[model samples]
Target: MQQDRMEARTAGWGQRQGWGRRADGLARAGRRPRRVAMGAMLLVAGIAWTAQTLGANTTPVCKLSVCWASEADKLRYECDSGCYFESNPVDVEPEAVCNVMAEATHEGSFSYMYRDSVNLVTTGIGNLLASVDDAVALPFMIEENGVSRRATEQEIRDAYNGLSSQSAECIAGNPRRCNTANSYAGENALRLEEDTINQLCQTRLANEFTPGLHRIYPDFDSYPSKVQAALYDMVYNLGEGGLSPPKWPSFNRAMGRKDWQGAADESNRPQLGTTRNDYVRDLLESAADEEEAGRQRLASCASPGFP
Candidate 1:
């Protein structure tokens, strides 16, 4: 009886041990597949993230391939190209994108005209262009700063059109306001924008001055050409109302009538008895200092960045 009991107990222990080993093997096999699956999922996620990043940066230049009904034969399209300025429905459409690109050519080919609104002052072609170049030229880019910027070709044209409209509204087309003496007054003087420059130059500056500033500056008594440029900078800073012109009534009447001292006196007055006398004093003194320096350090600072 004792031998039989011992044999049964031994068999039972062996059976228990075999069952435990089988369970351990099964658990390891299940864990290995789950680890492989988790690794595969992680790899897929990484690849997807990398792909998305690349897609975001790249702008597909569709060379007339994604051509919509409204697109031109040679139009170039990029990401969201037809959405803004060129769509047919005035929404995102095919023609709209083509129009956007077409606008670039027009703006590039178009002339830059700059004018002052305060005195109805308009700049000469040379001066206008140089100023515009000073504002906009930077390798292949032009920064608008507080002003709006058009990144693509379409954007440039859109900005040009919008500003052109503003120019029309600002100018009442007052002939006296457009005069070189008075026309070169507020707009361009105050607003150193492409549109303001264009209005002052194209509308009045081009037509208003006899030969532009050359015509007017020579008439100024005792005022040198360098001084005239300085005065314009002054005008740009201060309005026509702010202008004193060294006894201007006497100066204008004398253009050759007043003589040098008359114009100089009006220009150099310590007080004008109008507006903020203190402010006027500072402006006049600053402009004079810049002129006396006989270099472009101050004048360059006067205008804003890019038209």
Candidate 2:
């Protein structure tokens, strides 16, 4: 949210701040003031970079004065000392990035237990409870007489078992709309708050999905945001192994070559809905368009000009 807020503020400033006259005045001024201004600018840039590097919302356990060349280097030193970084540096904030995947996986829903298409007992944004331990690990709340309290382990186990026992027909027929209708829509239905669901999704993205994606695509951070999101969605839907070579050979080849259109052509997943498939395709195509536009801009900049 801090990143989102910062982007909005930057956009507003861009509209009002005309840099032409200020730049000209600064140029006219002595070189000393310009040097000082440049120093100030660099300092501000460093702060912004640091904020982005360590998730804006996350507080680092320890601070290091030494500069590191990459996030991996920073993590190696920091994590060795039991320090925790919220996430790796990404084009988009971790929370916003998770939201993109959540939209496709859970469709803006964040409460109540249900069954996924494959009949897995799931809750809050497609979070799967493979066993009773998984259910008890999460702090699920239950409501009674208009009051909310944390659900006991037995209550959680009961709810999970209730959903797990549902027939495949039930799962297919009713996916259980979030916050509205569910298999157990009675007095003490187990639920998770929106913030809790977001944290769960974000944690998985940061700890599991993102690290796995990085291992597969080593230069993942360098890719365009849309491409990154597309790859992220793939990894989330189909585990890291599912997107690697031998499993998705054609897609892997296209990605290796940085061929956005080729990758888009190979991105279809028969099991997923057309809308989700289209979203991934569109992201890849959009990246291709951006790459083409960048090339055109470079060419124009290099051309001989009378001015």
Candidate 3:
């Protein structure tokens, strides 16, 4: 039946009765309605399956150390939910250093990026890769002795706080960010601020979050992927400390149980300065540009990954 459908699709694409070349109309004729119906069916079926198989369809992807990216662990950086972390298909021996990630049910997760190996060297077990370059694939080769597996909840908390803590230095006592090393430099502060706003929207607000991004910002329904890409780029550009989401200190104020007045007050601190004021103002405007750029980017074939 699938073969018949394929053949029909192939023949349906040939030129029509009168036209010299195959027009979209002719190509779409027999296959159009079926394809449309098929697509609808698949959507419904997929959604139903997802709902039944995975409740809520929210909070996608498990948060593990590997799910995070960091300077320390090569495989840990941007590690998806499996034993393998590399992108390009490569070979590895059976179990070694990295254990194939399994669910609580003890079932293995499947990934297009992962494949079974045969007769490959088992020195490192190479089951889970971290990163891959042109010559070698996965970061399993980068392992050392002191590394630990599966981050503890304390580690997760510590990691999150530790990473987030660095934001203050740039935004700390130095309003100008002039003394700060990573502060966006020179006349580009406007661009820097705009970028920072986007960053705020992502990491602090969104984080290069795993699996589902659309859930957090339902407001971005019209431009799901675009807003996500913009948000990540912004977070990357702006430190997680200041300049995004609630815009940092204000964000911390709220986190610290400060009321709306305090939050708004902290948020408004930039208004007190010309340079900082100009930066925020430009960022709001830049968001529109970033959104449009995001739309164009989302429209393209590119799937925006983390910054």
| TM-score for all models, in order of appearance | 0.23, 0.65, 0.20
Q: What is the C-alpha lDDT of each candidate?
A: 0.30, 0.61, 0.26
Could you give candidate 3's per-residue lDDT for residues 1-307 as a string of tens digits? 5543433333211111212122344446743212211111122222211101111211111111111223223222222211121121111111110122122111122211221122111111112222222113211111136542333344333322222122343344444332221221221111112232233223323333311323333222222122223332223234343343455654344323412223233333432444433333343334334433423433332334422
Q: Give residue 8's lDDT in candidate 3 (0 to 100).
A: 30
Model 3 ranges with Cα > 4 A deviation: 1-34, 37-41, 44-223, 239-244, 248-307
RMSD of 3: 22.8
Better of 1 and 3 by lDDT: 1
- Best candidate, lDDT: 2
Q: How large is the C-alpha RMSD of every model relative to the true structure?
A: 34.1, 13.5, 22.8
Tens-digit per-residue lDDT, 1-307, candidate 2: 8774553233212112333234445657843223221111222332321211222322222222222445445444443332332222223456766687667442445577765665666667667778879989988998799999999999988887766455555445543422233544453478888898989888888788888977887656545557777887788788777887788889988887778788999999887778889988988887776656544433443346401
Model 1 regions more than 4 Å off:
1-151, 162-211, 217-230, 234-250, 258-261, 264-307
**Cα error of candidate 1 at position 201, Å:** 12
